[model samples]
Target: MDEFAFVDRSKTNAEKYVLRQKLFGTEEVMPLWVADMDIATPECVLEAITKRLAHPIVGYEIMSDSAYEAQIEWFATHHDFVMKREWLSYSPSVVASIGCAIRAFSDAEDEVIVMDPVYPPFYSQVRENNRTLVIHTLNQDEEGIYRFDLDRLSTQTSEKTKVLLLCSPHNPVGRVWSYEELSALCRWCEERGIVIISDEIHCDLVYAPHKHISTARIIPENTVMLLGPGKTFNMAGFSISTVCIPSQLLRDKFEIERKRVHWGDGAVLSHIGFEAAYREGRGWYYKLIAHLSQNAEYIDKTLSSTPIQYAKPEATYLAWLDCRALGMDDRELRKFFVKEARLGLSPGLSFGKEGSGFMRLNFAVTSQTLTEALEKLRGALQGDAYV
Candidate 1:
């Protein structure tokens, strides 16, 4: 394995080990569970944060016009989508924004639709707000690719459905939804007056041959999109997210909630990080995606040598490994890796009921780290977990 390819080693070492110890009770196990990248934030982002650290005070911050401008420019340059500054609102985190949207836009009894084996936060945000949580399970063909069953979704959604929490360039499974699929879903929601709250936080991490389309770009004005640099730049600890609302009515309602709750603002350092990443991190982002693609391919090749099997991920750094052939429940299998192999991974059951017999791995670390993890996994598979 190439040493330089393991960029995340120096930067993510401390957090990575702490997570490993927490999950598997030792630093000996390589952690590939968290969504955070093992790589350092770009040099530009690092410099900006350091420069801010030099200043003594960390005071209350109002988002600079330059910060907002950086966001607008990023979307236009990379995504080819344009937005006015007025459409943007700041939130501390996208998950928080999701809960707020559920409360402010939809009534208590209204249903919010999401795909199963989705980000776990989506499940909590819906149910915690007293809204009905409805899941639309994606169908998997013999090829192992997960595809949305629109007919099934159509049957599930009704006039009482008030929102759809969509994940584009979807999480865990890593599908950058096709234009046709997005358009059909958008039209269905638009016709029903059901608002679309797209958690497109993972929009920038799409792999080759896959394109991420903003659902609002294809649908009506009722769509609200959540985007941020936290995931793209590996700056989740900074805690900043942008909520994009196209409709004035919906925007006003969100503002009313914002005022009542007194949501916190992004840190000054976080603002600097965001500006630097959006303005100068484009090349770094491209290289990072290339590295991730190689890692995903590595997982594919490694799995073929063992009893484990998985379909290639088209987007995101996550690989969804189908461990059904091992004939163990997700919980038991996850335990086998932790106790037997000393490997930590995100269990499929955490995503949803449909995720049983599956495991999600994050290959965003260095090639060297992935190799060790895979070797350990190979050793684990030889145990009763396989039989």
Candidate 2:
């Protein structure tokens, strides 16, 4: 009955645990990598999935319109963006939609703009699809806030540039773009005839006083918004998400690619669970925000005097730690965390060149787990005396 309870995923064959040896070269470190939460999935989602199993047939079924409606309603209520049923379609995952959209919107060799230090898949999808990549680096201001320079972005594109992959409430660096920022980016992309693909999976996990504005809301006709309850309710195991394409022309193109892949209406249980997550999981979702906000603040305070520097993220559960003060190359940084700190965190260099001298820590764990991890980090730092 504890709303902030977390489950032990170590024995569950979860990727985060299973890949420790392969990723960090040791099973000794506590994994705080990967984006999914160690917090329990919402009870309402579990109950709905369990109820669906009472029927023995367990057959393939189309995702109910009501399930999509639940999402539409959630979006309107939370983000202040209303969606038409016609604009939405089922996707197995947001990354899958990004791949399909890449193929749907642009041809091989055309440029797709991706901001550096974004989710790694954003880079891979473009390369895998044979599209050229335009890397736009986001710089942090003196206040340690990550921001995109419009003037610099303007200098990076050309006629061959066809799409912009935007991570609103961006991953790794964790910035929730302001309304003025989103509006200006949309306007810039629109005038340049670029299709904006906004990935808003973390839309609902944002902290207080910081609002997540849907990019599609700014210029509906020019955006392809990828959304889902996977991150919000910790149900990524369901492999369910929705892609919203407001432009009929883009929808037709995306449909052609979607059909080619045949990522059919997802599973029946996922449909039940997705609906319950949005419609009935509000209480659990709010409690998670409080927990994550506390963790973010905790990291900010904990690392204030340490060699590592951390800026409390405006959104998402990720903590982007500045390790430049430690004065190690990326390889040493990775080694230090694995061998010295006994923590498996995401090395920032893997995100992009701009992520150098940084590491990402996932704070969506029980308070006790977070406390232990931070203590281990502090101990490691004190022992190394790297500063």
**Candidate number of the best TM-score:** 2
Provide C-alpha RMSD values for all models, in order: 2.7, 1.9
lDDT by residue for model 1 (1-387), tens: 442345535344456556676666666656778798877778889998898899899998888878889999999887888878888988999999999888888998899998998999999999888999889997687887788887788889878899998988788788888999899888888888888899999999887688888877897388889999988888887788899887788899988888877886667888888888899988888878877888889888988987788877888888898889888876679778787777778888889988888888888788888888887888777664421
lDDT of each: 0.83, 0.92
**How many clashes in each structure?**
1, 0
lDDT value for candidate 2?
0.92
**lDDT accuracy of residue 18 in candidate 2:** 98
Minimum summed lDDT over a 10-residue window in model 1 is located at: 3-12
Please give, for residues 1-387, the per-residue lDDT of candidate 2 as tens digits: 234766878889899999999999988989999899998898898899888898898899999889999999999999999999999999999999999999998999999999999999999999999999999999888888888988999998999999999998899888999999999999999999999999999999898789999998999989999999888898889999999998999899999999999999999999999999999999888889988999999888888889898888889999999999999999999999999889999999989999999999999888888888998899888895322
lDDT of 1 at 157: 83
Prediction 2 TM-score vs. true: 0.98
Question: Worst 10-residue stretch by lDDT in candidate 2?
Answer: 1-10
Clashing pairs in 2: none
